[model samples]
Target: MMKTLICNMTTYMPKGYSTTPVLFYLIISSRHLEDIPLQAKKCRNSKVELVIVSNPEFIQELLPSAQRTALLYHLSYLCLAKFPKLERILRERATETQLLFGSSEALLLKCAATSQNLVSTLLPSLKAAVEKNKSVLAIKSLEKARVWINEIVDKVEQMVKRYDKHNHSVASCTSDVLNEKAETEKQIEQASKEVDALEKAVIGLNQELWNNNQEIGRIEATIARKNNELQNHIRESSNKNNGLSFMVCLIPFVGPLIKSIHQAQANQALAVKTQAISNELSQLSNEKSNLKNKEWNIHVRLTDMQLKLATMKLEKGSIPDPVHLNDVQTCLTRIQQILIQIKKFWEAVSIMLEALKDETFADEHFIDDCEMKETFLKTITTAQKHWRSFGEYCLSARGIFSLQTKDAYNFLETSPSSLSKEEWKRQYDAVIVKLNKICPEVCTPKETAAIA
Candidate 1:
């Protein structure tokens, strides 16, 4: 039995069966031959000559269900086993279409995981399928594919920009590190130069220190030498000063001893001379005492002569005067004795006083001062000569006067009465007055009282 290709043919058939030949032809031509099949026994037994003719709608008809089913089967097999490359393309196209027509969840999931190769291979096919389908669903699927393609391309561009930015940042950081290293090397070189200069200065300072040490050593040596010399000089001076002090201590006693010994010898010789002078002075003192007594006696004799003269004046009126040789001779002898005693007394007194003066200044060295002692002796000699001469002359003159007056008086008394008694007495009185007037004083003499 042969099966018809179309199901439910009766529903699609015209209202009534067509009686016109054209109508039957039209109906048969609208359908595909594969929709039905003839049985073998029918083909063998029938000799029916049915001519198949072309209808206008034959080539432009719907595909039969059987052929459509067969085509779908072939495509599924190709996709699963025979045509892997094509199948991959178709699946990618299908996923793209689904992103457009299916849901937002499917498109979002595909965008996160889709590669560039998947998008490029599938998008064009998906666009072609939409154009061929020419339906609202197909157009929606095409728009979804376009949106995903744009989103992926934009993301890729952003990633490329980010990679470029990262490369630029690394280059900048590398350049900075290199500059820092170069600057550090320059600073190290400068520091090395400074250290070398300081080292040279330190060497110069060390040399100067050595020279200063040498100068100090020389100064120390000079000071040591000077100190030694000064010590020697001080020692020598101390010794000489000690010797001079010893000599000074000995001089006083030695000088006085030698001088005193010489003076004692000279004093011994002077002592003998002084003793002889003392003996002479003793004799002269004795004579001076005797002479003093004789001078008193002479004073008494003068007093007696004055009395006699005064008595003669009183007796001048009665007695007569005469010159006699024997009476003159006796009076002269008495006057001579008194005068000689006076002269001797004065000479002895002078010599004794001189000896006493010499004994008073009896220093051993007195004669060494010759000028003063010679002047003292000259004065003493002049005084002594004047005294001696005056005494001797006075004595001789008194003797002459006494002898002349006595001779005149005796002659007057013994003469023959040649003159009157009164005249004789007057002459005797005048002569006695003359005798008293001519005599030097033996006692203190009387001076005339000028007022009286």
Candidate 2:
């Protein structure tokens, strides 16, 4: 039977045997065979079965190239019943052959149910490849996330730096504004105090001016009384002369009596002339005292006005109130000009007084009637000229002061910028020039230095 099976396998097992046909051939061949040694089973079984086991080298050598994998698959099935000793070796060699030369899908599909050992050995390597792919994908995703996070961190840091710089600049600007506001407030307070002080000073000056006006009125009244007394003395002396002339003409025969009466009249007239000179000297002394008082009051007013002007100037530096400052300057300048005129008037009066003191009035009671009349006329003309000059000086001073005060008021009412610095300086210099003209001997070194 082994001989017959070996001959049939050799004849029918072609290079292209289907897996089902090859497996059916191995099962039928195994069912007919017995389990015995090849040499002992030669006479008991068929020659076909005996020949298949006895000559394994011949079956191996007869297998076609196309049928080797199918033959191995079929041989593994037969080894389960007829060839048990070759089962492990057949499966190992078939698996190695399929792995090296066959497609993986075809090999796994063909051997899946019958090849448990092959599936078990490959399970670990398949799982490792899948785990390795998952690790690579996770690494790529982490790298992308890290790049985006780094970008966000850099952007946030830049924004923080910009905010810090902006905050610092705002803080600095706020501090500067506060400081400027404080300085402005301080300047306003200082200006207000200065203005108040200036107002008080102006009120005081007005009171002083009123007192000076009252003093001038009293002086004028006293001068009028003295002039009336002088006129009465002149009238009485004229009547006595007319009576003497009538006696001298009517009683020429009684010459000694007329001469005695004439001598007594001459003595009485000399005594009356001495008394009149003494009274004139006393009146002149009182006038001098009044003039001195007026001068002192004017000087004090000028000094106070100048001090107030200085204070106003200081306030103007901060407040810039041009109109008020200009008014103060104008009033101060006019007062200075008036003071200079008064000084000039005083100097002229002194010269006139010195000339009067140097003059020698003749005692003309023993002289001819014409000579006596000539002396009296000359004395009256000199006194009238001096009195007229004093009245003219007072009138001129008053007129000039009134005009200057009106001009100062006008200037104050006008717009401040209308008077340019150069124009104002020119006007001030003109006043100084007029003062110099009035009193050439007056020293003005301090005023010159201040202008400079």
Candidate 3:
């Protein structure tokens, strides 16, 4: 179950990297993230990477040494490269969301769901852009998403200034959900307990599955290597046995040649080893598939329980509590949805990019491969990746969305500022005065003096 894990990003670089000569050509690269490391970094707001980093010895619980190390390094690089100011983005996330949606947690969930739907809907377009080789379409697709992203990023600054006064948490608006509907209380409590237990099981199962998949990968890699060795051994034996005089094999020290004659015909030991490894791999794969099904079933049950509990709370009017929607599932909703773009980009990458593996340079014979190194530079410097990252960042702002709709409005009404209160009174008085002047109707802005 051990794998020689060699993680290389070079294989998944943007396509046609060698078509240009300059190391820094104006890259018209489309926004795409077809790389594993990149996806992992973006997944779960980089919690996946955090897990790997925290559990260094957890390689034994996941991938082998080389795979884990490379994955960690690559994911770390991807995160740093894509999300330069991660901490800042995360810190102001909630308040900025509150400004746009006006203390509505439901708005956040809506946006998250909407963003996910958009990405899902746009996937075919993304794939088509790559397939048709229409770079313009790809650019335009990203540009449309870019508008929303910029709006969010730009509006956030103003929102922070606008909503700072209301930043303080509201009073107990959710006492109803927390302490209401006595009959439903038992059902909610039981569901909650069940959800908690199922969540733990799912987490444990997922970890095991991850580790199992890694082991399967290792076994498959070993089988491939062993198969190649077997063929190479037979081929070498045949070559040595060829053009050698029969009398040369009659010498006293020709033991290897005689053995080659037998090995050239059939290497039983190598075959047996490969078969055993192959059988182990097949069994492991089968087990992994079965457990994966079990995991999904448990996940479905957990989701059902969670939904029932949430519905009960919503009906009881306790959803105004921020904690109701401020959980990992909500955070993942945005991240998980944005991950679709990665899949689309990956499809394009796999099709358009040639995986020129390391063996290309095995002989130290550098052919007309001059532009290859520079092309690698293109993958590094491409703005396409940046655009893709930005789009995802924008969509992921849906994380700011929640289910709380009552809290912010409550703050604005109960904790109105002096400026706001005075402005409202002035407007109301002017309206009344104008109504008196114009036979009891609305006010004109110039009628402020008449109102006084």
Candidate 4:
């Protein structure tokens, strides 16, 4: 991941990127190297390229993938080596593009997708111009682009093949980080679901507790009413017994039998009913207590789950997203495919130029009326027809140029950041305007502007 505070990428990397702030090397001078006299005599005959690149180690890297993708990593360290603000913009864009599209292949696809319209429209006209009109400038321009593109692509392929071992590939290293992030997300989701379930359970238990409390209150009220009714019934029975039993006292055995039968009176039956209701109330009270305990346990679980989910989410945020390595085969194939079209397209133009340059022999001996002269006229007409076919070949060059493809695969050297026509120029200008509070290049350093 780009955000990782990593050391030298890996043991496999032959060299790590410079921690310097500059991006590209500054040229010594257009003329003699006499500005800095300290070492002028010692390096009077040195190659300018070597002197311009003061730091030899800046361009080299042990990681092949890093070499292909160094612009995403160390250009900030080198070009804007001194400009933190500018470096930061590049860093932001790098991070944005990477996270937005997880794979290099996908990014390439995005860049390549826009080529269809160009092929359908612009290329057909260019093809017509080169074949029918025979424009030399179009041929040269496309040829120049093709040559530059081929050399760059070939170097990339070599680098990819050089460090493509199982362990050396950056994909393996970043995979670990990606795996950690994915696992953290999974854990967070599971904990969140558990917390939600526990919360629902707690709510359900609370409702049950409230309902049980109401049932207990109702049972208690019923018991109170039953007791009052029993008391009234007892009073009535006592009054009746006092009158009848006294009169019936002469018949002692009959009075005793009536008293025994009076034992099943309404008041006694009410007492038995109240006792049963009281037992039911006690059972309900026990059930309410059990629900309370269950709710408390669920509450604890919910809190714990919530904490765990938070922790997992935090971990997920900290783990930087994986920076994908461009697909070597696909990129090479795409580049080669584009080059083939441009090459064929331009080759036709080159042949057309040769044909245009070919004068009609400047011969007075050849005449249209003679059979041999007719042959000469027929040759000219046939050459003109073949020129059209060449035009057709050149027009097939679809998506010959792309800003996205170039940005997706930009490279930089050991120089400081400055305005140049390369893909990173716009970024440099934008950063200057953003941080310096002046339009791009308005307050450009004299030397930086000279270099640009």
Give the winner by TM-score: 1 or 3.
Answer: 3
Better of 2 and 3 by lDDT: 2
Q: Candidate 2 — what's its lDDT? A: 0.31
Alpha carbon deviation, residue 61, candidate 3 (Å): 21
Q: Give, for candidate 3, the lowest lDDT window spanning 10 residues.
A: 18-27
Q: Candidate 3 regions off by >4 Å?
A: 1-266, 320-452
Q: Judge candidate 3 at residue 329 and give its lDDT.
A: 21
Q: Please identify model 1 stretches exceeding 4 Å from their true place.
A: 1-347, 350-364, 370-378, 381-385, 388-452
Per lDDT, what order, best first? 4, 2, 3, 1
Tens digit per residue, CA lDDT, model 1, 117-208: 22343333333433343233333443454454455434434433443443343334334434543543454333344444544554554455
- TM-score per candidate, chains pooled: 0.19, 0.26, 0.24, 0.19
What is the clash count for each candidate, in the order shown?
10, 14, 7, 17
What are the per-residue Cα lDDT tens digits for candidate 2 across 201-255?
Answer: 7677666756765664455445335434532433243334533322221111112
